[model samples]
Target: MTKIADLRSQTVDQLSDELLKLKKEQFNLRFQAATGQMEKTHRVSEVRKDIARISTLLREKRAAS
Candidate 1:
């Protein structure tokens, strides 16, 4: 999970990269769940929240500029 402060310190490009990675992780988690091979089920929610946070931050940055 990423801290908001840490994310806030990063540039937009960096945040975009992080968001992409998290999205990929979320996809893998979903796949794992579907296959009944998921161990840490809580990670799905964490990754989702992280994605939301990054998206919100990105929107705020764009709107501010």
Candidate 2:
């Protein structure tokens, strides 16, 4: 799992890309859960948090820029 502080150290575009990837992963996780094939249920929450973290970092970077 990526931390907010770590994400804060990254560039805006990098953060955006990471956020998109995380959202995709989250979608996959949900799909897996729906099919009763999720091996890690906690991952759903983790991915959600990562998405929030990336968004926060992106917002901060934008504000700073």
lDDT string, candidate 2, 1-65, tens digits: 88656776788888888888988998999899999999999999989888888887788778988
- lDDT of every predicted structure (CA atoms): 0.95, 0.85
- Which stretches of model 1 miss by more than 4 angstroms? none
| Error of model 2, residue 61, in angstroms | 0.9
Best by TM-score: 1
Residue 21 accuracy (lDDT) in model 2: 91
TM-score of structure candidate 2: 0.91
Query: How do the predictions measure up, each by TM-score?
Result: 0.97, 0.91
Q: Please give the lDDT score at residue 2 for candidate 1.
A: 85
Candidate 1 TM-score over all chains jointly: 0.97
- Candidate 1 global lDDT: 0.95
Per-model RMSD to reference: 0.5, 1.0
lDDT (10s digit) by residue, model 1, range 6-64: 99999899999999999999999999999999999999999999999999999999899
